[model samples]
Target: MTPGSGLEQHPLLPWLALQHTRGIGPVRAAKLLEQLGPRWFLSPRLPDCGLSEAQLVQLLTPSWSVLEPLLEWQRQGPARHILSWDHPAYPELLKTLSGAPLLLFVEGDPDALSLPQLAVVGTRHPSYVGKENTRNLVTQLVDVGAAITSGLAIGVDGLGHQAALERGGVTLAVLGSGLEQCYPKRHRRLAGDIVDGGGALISECYPWEAPQAHHFPRRNRIISGLSLGVLVVEAAERSGSLITARFALEQGREVFAIPGAWQNPQAGGCNRLIQQGAKLVCEVNDILEELVAFSTAALKIHPPATEELLPYPDLLDNVGLETTAVDLIASRCQQPVQEVVTRLVELELAGWVESVPGGYVRARRS
Candidate 1:
């Protein structure tokens, strides 16, 4: 059924209750629903469904107070919606997963979930090249009629959404917190833009639930699950983006990674994924060719641009993957400390190097 259709009957309550019910997580809930069907809440067989007595009691007499905020939030606007497992608007791609969310709180076009999506995820501190790659790929993906999906994070995630919006393409932001409590506090505006741009902001958390550390890993699954595939723009050896890529693999969704230079730490995760059998993507067609159904038309392929020479080669050579002190770099280059600092700033702006806590490190190679 469509959202807001059965609000008075509170059809979503049972799903929400099942969600908050202790000991019955998404996997168990999905299995139970699979076995007993949507009307299982009223069945006499609930006692035989493997739930403990206390769990059964909690399900039978769900705390209405706990669910009021979500219900109220949905009522506040026509755009806001709550999708139960049985809802027609629940994304079909996500439903195939074993541990799919019981309920989805959506704040935008629910139909956007049904569109072909490619998830773009990466580090929070992306290199300038990483940002450029994300924007360039997203722009072309938009041209191919694919929706961009990502966590509403600061670096790559935010850039993906912004790029899609700038291209006037649909994008979805899966959140680690409730719809009301936009995490990072910085992307709240971007979240609004997603909704305003005919995209969506989605979350499985309760309306007022704060973002906890554990919430993000679970959030990653939704990002991957909702998409046809996931693209790792730039990630470290250990990153949440890798978790999303892992989920994409388990979900049977195609996984794509952009190869990065060996010396770039941010590119380490992508390189690792390529080694592990993820399709190495160099352009939009690499993805479109795999998800053939999403390709709308042939793209005008362009030749690769000539790589520019690295400015201040001597100064850059002094910087390494590990943070190198400015003084050490100056001594190595035999330049004054002030001159070294000025050139370093130019290098940083050029995306050749970045300043870190200890000093400077090489940024991603283009």
Candidate 2:
């Protein structure tokens, strides 16, 4: 179905027009939408709609040239969709951000946006361990029913999408370039796989817009905005993933960073993030533990059916977030240490639990 099918007239034109204005941004556009309802955009009136003189004049005379082609593009693809800020289907988490996109171009399952999401991000050039960590964590995260969100760039972002799809999980790739101009051309096919796998390719730029330097950093906000938390796998001192983490902090979202080898230049950003108080994650469960509390609020809107407990739910509950030894956990669960150790490994891979220096701890709540 079309994104705005039920409406009398497509609202894409006004939403696109509002974004196209030279000086107006998401913050200003949101204000305008709040003051003048859709009728003002449809009727093109110049009333006291809280806009400055220049903005009022611009609103009165929207650039139809920029909007017309976008409308045409939307009509061409059945799965393509446009989400305006006021649309009921807009992501609630994203809508809370002052810099959230006024218009989002989606090219897959739009409902995917409403699902619980965790942003996985890192440097474009990652170490082997970084790639492994991303893939393993993404697979485990999806296994537990959480959707993965990433930028769909090279390295960590690309690995995140591939891992999610490989595990039969849903993933969302937030793009810096438009759908038509997939950045890092090497990953174009990967982009298709994401949509084909029931995931989505999202962009704030027009379909034909090319990847510009500013666009990537600007798009970082959406990555953090869409997710409950941002997880940094690996990053250099100055990397885009750090930018996303900063945005996550500003948006009141949790930030998790994986510690890498101290000497690896790629790890500088992540180490600094931990020093600055972002959660230090060693394995998948670490991320899940942080996500549970954040996701609880979103789940309340339409309470989902309770998730099926993993094997050994009782044993898992015996291990809390606090540190505990294997012997102690075994004693609490009334199981043998050998069996407990084996089960803990399984739980660690599934992201339900973690193993520490002393013993094991609950990484995710049952």
Candidate 3:
């Protein structure tokens, strides 16, 4: 039913009520559905539905206040939809996870969920090279006719969605906040662009719900659950991108990572993944090679072989894992101070060396 269409007799109002109930989570909702089926709300009493006493009351007393905004949101656009778990169009991949969302509030074409997806995730504060790598990788992935999916935050996530849109490929932005609340506020325009470009803006929260710290980690599961594989471009040792990688592993999806300069804090998690046996992706082919069974077109796309090079090979030899003074590095390399500074800048961009307070440190070379 369209939002604001008919609250009085809408078939889904009761289900919405159950969703809005304070203590009735997906597990409890599932238990109730099992006991009472689709029309579980019609049952006179909740004693046998496995709901706690307070939850039973909350469910019985439907909250029009909480349900009204959702309906209003639906009324705002024809593309918006509230998908119940039983909706035939609900994503099969997500349904396989335990305690999956009972209702998915979607904006844009829901059919995009049926297409093959690859999740690209990384840090919010990516280095310049990390951002460029993400954009290029996303472009190649889209060429193979797969929908890109990400959390839609800044850095790599936003870059992935933007690349897909620029290439006219479908992408999905799964939000940590409500569709109406668009977290970070700056991405509000980006969110609109996604829906306008035939991509999607999705949420499991109410339309007006504000973002919380916990929402993002919960949101990560959905990103991995919806995709055939996940690629971590760059992330810190303790970044949330690693959490998404863990979720992908748990969901039985392939995990891919690009090894970066060892000195890059952002590359720490990705390097660790490579050490732990995640596919070390140097090019899109590394990802496509694993996804051949998932997307036949991937086999047709011939990505160039991976290339690894040092911008200034000699400069790095003078730098070590420990910080070394600029003058000392220049003296050791036998290069002029001005030349050394220029080379250091170039090496940093190549993710080979990082400038420290006193001088520079060499990053791990893969």
What is the per-residue lDDT of model 3 for residues 21-128, given as tens digits with 9 covering 90 to 100? 887777677777767776777776557755678877776675666667777889999999998877877898887776678888899999887678999999999999
Q: State every prediction's TM-score relative to the real structure.
A: 0.77, 0.76, 0.74
lDDT of all predictions: 0.89, 0.84, 0.85
- Model 1, 85-185: lDDT tens per residue? 88999998899899999889999999999888889999999998999999999999988788999999989999999999999999999999999999879
In candidate 1, the residue pairs with backbone N, CA or C atoms under 3 Å apart (3 or more residues apart, or in different chains) clash, namely none
Report the poorest 10 consecutive residues by lDDT, candidate 1: 294-303
Flag regions of model 2 displaced more than 4 Å: 1-9, 34-46, 296-366
Model 2, 183-294: lDDT tens digits are 8899999988989989899999989999999999888999999998999999998998999999999999999999988899999999999999999998777776666655
What is candidate 1's local distance difference test score? 0.89
Candidate number achieving the greatest lDDT relative to the actual structure:
1
